[model samples]
Structures are given as C-alpha cells and as structure tokens.
Target chain A: MKGLAELGEFGLIDHIRARFPQPVAPELGIGDDAALLSPSAGRQVVVSTDLLAEGVHFDPGFGPARLLGRKSLAVNLSDLASMGAIPRWFFLSLAIPAGFSLETIEGFLDGLAEQAAEHNCILAGGDTCGSKGGLTISVTIMGEQRPELILKRSGAQPGDDVWVSGSLGDSALGLKLLMEGVRLGGAHDPLLLRQLDPTPRCELGLKLAEAGLVNAMIDISDGLLADLGHICEQSVCGAEILLGQLPLSPALYTCSSKQPVFPWPLVISGGEDYELCFTAPRCNREAIQKISKTAGIPLTVVGKVTNSRQVQAILPDGTNFQPSASGYTHF
Target chain B: MKGLAELGEFGLIDHIRARFPQPVAPELGIGDDAALLSPSAGRQVVVSTDLLAEGVHFDPGFGPARLLGRKSLAVNLSDLASMGAIPRWFFLSLAIPAGFSLETIEGFLDGLAEQAAEHNCILAGGDTCGSKGGLTISVTIMGEQRPELILKRSGAQPGDDVWVSGSLGDSALGLKLLMEGVRLGGAHDPLLLRQLDPTPRCELGLKLAEAGLVNAMIDISDGLLADLGHICEQSVCGAEILLGQLPLSPALYTCSSKQPVFPWPLVISGGEDYELCFTAPRCNREAIQKISKTAGIPLTVVGKVTNSRQVQAILPDGTNFQPSASGYTHF
Candidate 1:
C-alpha cells in the first residue's frame, strides 16, 4: 500500500471521505468549511471531546490498528452514553507520523466505520495533518436529547442506590496481562478483548434515561470509585460501596483464581471499563433491572449514596478497604 | 510556578475551568460527562475543527505562548467565518508534554480567553492530558446561522465578481523573515503580527452573508490563488485575478522593495492570511462596498468568475502568471 506521503493530504482526506459517505444532506457533511447540522426540534446538543496520545494512552505495538480506532470512538461514545444522548455525529482530528501506511489508515477507518454504523453516527467534520510524534487521535462527538430527560452528575440524592452496568476490573486486568506478554489462548481472550474493545453501554443508558430511573450517571472510564466520586462530589453526597457486591465478569473470576493475589485493587480502581456507573432512587430498582434485562446488560446495585461527603468502601467481611490509588491520571 | 507534574492533571483542569466561566446556563459548561448546549430556535449548528501541532504548525521558540493559543482558536474561527456562522461555543483538547510550566499554560489561556471574549464564544468543554511529544492543541468551534443565510464555496456563478477582504502575502512574508532571522523593529511589526496573530474576518463574512451580497465565501487560510482555486473548483467555474489588483499590505510593499525578487509567489500561494475571499454578482458591488465601509475593513475586487474550469492570474501587462505551488499541504 502507498504511504501517507504518497497519498498526500487531500488524497488522504478524499479516501477517508469515500469510506464514510455523508449520511445527511450533501451540504452538511465533509468538504465544507464547517458542517451545518440541524438538531431535532427542541432537542439539546450534547458534545464530548477526548484525546488519545501514543505512548500515553495506547501502545502501538500491542493493539491492532482497527481496535485502536474502535476504542478511540468507543471512549467518546461512552461519554455521550453517560449523558443519555443518542449518538449522532463526531469530528476526528488525527496527527499521523510520516511514512505511515495507507493500509493502516484504511484498517483504522474500517473499524471506525463499524462503530459509526452501529451507533448511527455520521462523520461530520475533522482535521488531519502530519505529526512529528506518535499517532494522536482526538475526537469531538455530538449527540442530541431532550433537555428534561438528560442525565447529569449532580442529580443524585441521599439514599439513592449506587449501581454499575456490565462488569468491572476486566479491562484493567487485561492491560496488565498484555503488558506482561501473557497470552492465554482461549479462556483469557475475553479479558484481553475487554481492554482492546469495550462496549459503551449506550442502549442501557438510553433506556435508563428514558425511563427516568437514573438520578445521576457517569461512565466508568476512570474506574468505578473515581467516576463515582465525581457523581458524589457534584451531587453533594457521599457513597459507600460493598466489596462483595462489586460485579466481576466470569472471565475475571476465572483468571483471578489462578493468580497469587485476588486483584481486588484492579477491580476497585483500575480504569477504562466503559461501563455505566449511576445512582437511582431505591423505588426504581425493579424498573432499572427490567430495563437492563431488556438491554441485555447486567445491572448491579453495589452501594448507597450517603449524606456524608466522602467515598467509602466496605470489605466482604465488614472491614474497610483502601486503595493505593483512586484511578488513572494523565499527569 | 509549579510544573505540570506538581499541579497534577485534575489540578490543571480546575485551573483552566476557572479561567473561562460558562456564560450560558451553568449546566451547559465544563464539569459534566458532556456539555449540553441549546441552540437558538430555527438556526442550524455550524461546526469546524482544526489542529495545531508543534514543529509542523508552530515553532515554540519563535512565537509567544499567548499568541500560539490565540492563533489556534483564530484558525478554527476562520473556518466558521467562511460559513457565515456566529461563534457560540468551542471545545479544546490539549496534549501537553511533561515538564511544561504552569505559567506557559496560563499565558496561553490568557490569549485564548481574549479571543473568546472578543468573539462572544464560550469554552464549553475539552480534554487535557500528558503528552510524550510536543504540545498539541485541537479546537472544535461551534456556531449558528440561519439556514438560508449561510454561505458556501459552491455558489459562485460565471458572472460573479471575485473579492477579497484585507491584504495577502503579509503573513507569508512574515514567516519567511522569521525563518531567516530578520527582525525589522517597528515598520515590519504588522507583518509579524499578521502571521503570529491573525484576525478572522468574521464580521465581514456575517455582513456579506446577511446582506446576500456574496455568492460564495471562503477564508483565505491557503493563500489567494489557492483559496480562490477552492472557490473555482467547488463552484465548477474558473477565475481570472489581476496580478496588479492583488491586495498587498503596506508592510509587504515596504519589505518587498528591499528584497531582490518581487514576492508575487508568496502573495499567490502563501498560507495563513485568514482573509475572506468571496464571489459576488456584479450588481452587489455598491452594497458590498457600503458594508465594507461600515465594517471598517478594506474590500477589494480583484477578479471575475469565468466559465472556464481553472484559476488564472494576469499580470499588469496582461500576460499570464504562474505560481510555483498552489498552497500549503500538511503532508
């Protein structure tokens, strides 16, 4: 395949434009100075932006280009999901190093296309240029939802049940395994996939928001405790999560049994799960469960919101559990 | 001042969030999973994104941190200006390398805030992280315009008059001088300012679009002929610009007189002018001049749209002129 220099900037843009055909009005997509988007009447626009820098966010040699692209969009989609907005449009800014292969770009686009198609989001507008550093991908995603139905981190009240969707700790463990160069063929592949490819839990988030079941919500990108701390701090309340109640995937359980330590810290504070961690009033438990079942994702109530202004964790045997670090910080 | 590592990532974000207070509803700004924006009724949202990479886009040693920040937003705002959109909100994503000083970041934000206030734009959301490479800034600016009043590059007609706001080649000459380490203290400061801190022709663009005086509009980030070339290609027509009629700033003329070769190539193909190049019908000339007087920016008619499908330049003696290159390409 031809390299990026051979393709040139405009040729690269045309190639990318061809991959993601404009799904909206021809005037509203790529090629314009700016994208013109008409939001559905009365719906508010929701926007979230994230950056993935090489050597900091990802290791180029470890993950496939396709999965890296998928994860890039997935992380931003997770932010929208937490806001309970329907994924609509995204702008991508890529800084690629010189001599990068067009085949790798195509592979990246292939994976990005898959996610965009599944979420029904369009590639609205973006900027691409050569980078003197490693690949840097920045995405700004926009979605729409009725203002009254949107979720925020500041809505939780005392006595609300703290809940989490899917499972936790799998992704962090997966990263650990990958770093150690441990490749367990079949059984542990799920763990590795959890790190490489995360599901954003959009459907479940939409359902919860639509049902008016969630009091506050945030995606578990910075781990359960750290993200929950955000909701607690903003909501002006505290949370106490039970260690025994923390949901662990079957794959995590099977892998942890063979390890020397139980890996509870990874389960507690490890990052990049992309699962929804939210709070709801006690009366909506049955309703939330029904919605989760409908969405085919597990919902576990692991804690309760308290009047105190701190996050506390209880061990299974009734002792207090303290993590060395709360979560990941870029700096 | 503390370095980035001393301040920590969250601390740095808090510092940034404090600088640009949300001018809209409190729920619409930073500190959420995503920013929530309510667009004006019946208006379409216009979005543009641009990336300024270190080394490739800017020389950190040459320009001040404040101007670097200002230029980052100005370039994106130029895209919005070309579309006749009123600036509203912007998202910034910065990848800062380790050991960077907090003072530099604060200085950068100071200049960015100045531009944001001038344009009446708010910082709605963004992401910040540690970078292993040079500092990278990606900005996505969103604006709004009435659907019918928005301008585009595809509207120039065969009989239209080609116009440009402000002068050309000043920024290009400034860059050339800076590269050669030529510093003219007082007389040439305007040229340097033109390159380091470009003023987006937003007001002129809005007036032109609102008055329906322009058929096609684009910001001249990619030089005169190159950007006019965009208008020609997109409008499916050709253009012939008068070389003698090309707008040259007084600073450019003063500097060019001292140089051996006339800088016509830079005038034609230099990038980052941030002027407005547009096409209008012959009938709108009087009205456009009136708007230009009211806006207090020079509006010059330098050419005409033709049925041919190429961009051409004519010398003072009516000879065809050729440019060494069309414009800047990142790759």
Candidate 2:
C-alpha cells in the first residue's frame, strides 16, 4: 500500500469521500470553503469537541487504527447522547505523522463510517494535515434536539433518583489488563472489547428525552462518580451512591475476585465506560423500567440527589466510603 | 501565576471561561456536556475546521502566542467569508505539551476573545488535552447565510470576470523575510503584520453576496492562482489571469527587487494570503466597484473565466506562462 505522504491533502480527502459517501448528500460536503448544513427546523443544535493524542489517549501497541477511529467518534457521540440529542453531523481534524500508511487511514475511515452509519451522522467537513509528532484526532459533533427535550446537568432535583445504564468498570478493568499484560489466556476477551469499542447510548438517551423522564443526564466518560459530581455541581445538589447497586458485568466481578486490589475504585472512578448516568423523578421508576426492557439495556438505581452539596458513597454493608482520587485527569 | 500543570483540566477551563466570557449566552455554553445553539429561521449553517500545528503551520519564532491565536481564528473566519456567511460560533481543541505555561494560554485566550468580540462570534465549546508532542490547535467555526446569498465555487459562468480583494503576496513575502532572518530592522514590518495577523475580507464578501454581484467566491489561503483554480474546477470552466493586472503591495515589490528571483510565482502560488478571490458577471463590474468604494478595500480585476478547462497565466507582454507548481502541498 502507498504511504500517507503519497496521498497528499486533497487526495486523502477524495479518498475519504469515496470511502464514506452519505446516504443523503448534505447541501455541500468535502469541497468548497465550508460545508452547508440545513439543520432541522425549530430544533436546537448541540455541539461537542474532543481531542485525542496518540500516547495520551491511545497507544499504537493497544489496537489497530480501525478501533481507534471507532472509539474517537464514539467518545464524541457519548457527549451528544448525554445531552439527549440526535447525532447528525461531525467535523474531523486529523494530524498524522509521516510514514503512516494509506491503508491505515482507510482502516480508520472504515471504522468512523461504521459508527456514523449506525447513528445516522454525516461527515460534514474537516481538515487533514501533516504532524511533526504523533497522530492527533480532533472531532466536533453537531446534534439536534427540541429545546424542551434537551437535557442539561442543572435540572436534577433533590428528590430525583440517580440511575445508570448498562454496566460500569468493564472498560477500566480492560485497560488494566492490557497494561499489565494479563490477557485472560486468550484474545477477544469481553472486557478488552469493552475497552476498545464502546457503544454510545444514543438511542436510549433519545428515548428518555422523548418520554420526558430524565431530569439531568451525562455520559460516564470520566467514571460514574466524577461525571455524577459534575451534575451535582451544576444542579447545586449532592448525591449518595450505593456501592453494591452499581451494575457490574459478570466478567468484571470474576476478574476482580482474582485481583488483589478491590476493583471498587475502578468501578467508581475509572473512566471510558461511555454509559449513560442520569437522574429522574422517583415517580418515573415504572416508566424507566419499561424503557429498560424495550431498550434491551439494564437500568439500575444507584443513588439519589440530596439538598446538600457533598457527594458520598455507601458501602454494601452500610459503611461510608470515599475515594482518594476522582476520575481521569488528562494532565 | 500558576502553571498549566497546577491548574489541571477543569481549572484551566474555568480560567478560560473567566477570561473569555460570551457576549450573549447561547442556549447552552461552557461547563455543559455540549453547547446548544438556535439557528435563525431559513438560514443554512456553514461549518469549517482548520488544524494548525507548531512547526508545521507556525513557529514560536514567528510571533507571540497572541498573534498566533488571532491568526488561528482568522483562517477559519476566512473560510466563512468565502461562503458569504456571518460568523457566529467557534470550537477550539487544544493539545498542549506538559510544562506549558498558563501565561501563554491566557495570552492566547485574550487574542481569541478580541477577535471573537469583533466578529460577534462566541466561544461556544471546545476540548483541552495534554499532548506528548508539539502543540496543536484545531478550530471549528460555524456560521449562517441566507440560502440565496450563499456564494459557492460552482456558480462562475464562462464570461465571468475574476477579481481579487486587496493586494497579494504580502503574507508570502513576510514568511520569506522571517525565514531569511531579515527582521526589517526590528518591529512592525507591514509584510510581517500581514503574515501574522491577516484580516479576513468578511465585510467585502458579505457586500458582494448581498448585492448579488459575485457568482463564485473563495479565500486566497492557498494563494491566488491555486484558489482560482479551485473555482474553475468546481465551475467546470477555465481561467486566464493577466500578470500586469495582479495587485502587488509596495513592500512586496521592493523586497522582490532586492532578491534575484521574480516574485510572480510567490504572488501566484505562495499560500496564506487570506484575501478573497471571486468571479462575477461583467455587467456587475460597476456595482462591484461601488461596493469596493464603500467597503474601503481595493478590488482588482485580474482574470476571466473561459469555456476551456485549463487555468493559464499570462505575462505583461501577453504570452502564456505555466508554473512549475500550483500551490502548497500538505504532505
């Protein structure tokens, strides 16, 4: 395969266009000074951006370019899901080092196209350039939601019940296993897959917003505790989470049993889960349960908002617990 | 002042917020999962993204962080200007190496805030991350334009008169001077200022589109000939540019006389001018002249679109001259 240096800027862009043609064309795409997008009438636009550096966010040793590209878009989609918006368009800025292969770029585009097609998002516009260092991918996603249906972090009431979607800690444990060279005796471990390719809870988030059940919502990117803390800070409230109530996969439970360190910290503060953590009125429990069944994802009540401004954790045996550090720190 | 390491991610974000607060809050802004913006009725959104890397796009030796920050936003605004769109919001994703200072970041933010206020654009959302390599800034700008007034590259007719706003080659000469270690006896060289802080021809572009005088438009980021070539390709037409008619700043002419090489290629294909190159019907020339007079910017007619598909340059004596290279290649 030819290297990336051979493709140049316009060639790479044309390659991307050929590889990932949208089912419906935008008003303008890939060419011109800017892409033109007609947003849905009467809906508010939601935008989120994320920058992923090579060594800081991922390692070449960890996975192939395809999965890395998938995770990058998934992370941004998670932010849109948190806002209870429908994913629509995205802008990608890629800085790739020399000697990178064109095949690798195609693999990355393949992964991005997969996720975009699944979520009905269009690749609107972006920039690609040569990097003097390692690969850096910056993505900005634009989504839409009705103003009333839009979810923010400031609406959680004191009596709201805090709930989490799917399971947590699996991705964190997967990263730990990858770092320690403990591969669970084979490839394709479920935990490792969780770490490599997270599924954004986009559909479930839209359902909750459409049903008018969620008071406030955020994605569990920087772990359950830290992201929940963000909602609390914005809402001027506190939360008490039950340790035993956190939904953990059977794989996570089994792996933690074999390790010396209690995996509670990973479950609580470890990040990259991409799960939806939200709060709603306690009276909406039955409605949420119905959603859980229809959405095919487990929804667990892990905590409740309080009038105070302290976030506390409760152990399974009713003892108070506190984590030494909170969430992932990029710096 | 505390260093960036001491401030951490959220702390740095809060610092940015305090330093660059929005003129008017959108539906949502910083400190949220994603920003929310409401688009005006019947207007199409124009989106563009650009990535500028240290050493690739700019060096610390070239200018201070303030000018670098201002140029970064200016480049994106130029794209919006090319589309005849009113700039509205921007998202910045910054990757800074460890040990980076807070003072530099604050200076950068100050410059960005100044430009944002001038253009009426809001710093709506962004991502800040730690990089193991050189600093990279990726900016995504969003704008709006009435659908009918939107200027595109595909609208030029065979008889359209090709025009460019302001003088060319000033920015290209500035970079040459910087590299040759000729500081023009220190401080405030007009060429250096042009390269460091290019003013996007936003108001002129808007006037042309609003008056329906321009059929096609593009910013001269990749130089005049190359950018006009883009319009030819999109419009499926040819162009013939006259060398004598090309606008040259006195600074460029003086510098070129001092050097052995002719400045034609630099003026034709050297990048980063950030001026506007456009095409309009011959009948609209008088109207365009009127707008140029009111806008206080020189508008020069240098070329014409043709029925053939070749982009040719002609000398002052009227002989065709072909360039060895067309423009900047990012590879």
True contacts kept of each: 0.87, 0.88
Candidate-wise lDDT, in order: 0.90, 0.89
* Candidate 1 error regions (>4 Å): A183-186, B183-186
Q: Candidate 2's residue-wise lDDT over B66-144, tens digit each?
A: 9888988999999999999999899988999898878788878878888888888888889999999899999999999
The CA lDDT at B215 in model 1 is 91
TM-score of decoy 1:
0.98
Quote the lDDT for B143 in model 1: 97
Off by over 4 Å in 2: A23-26, A182-188, B23-26, B183-188
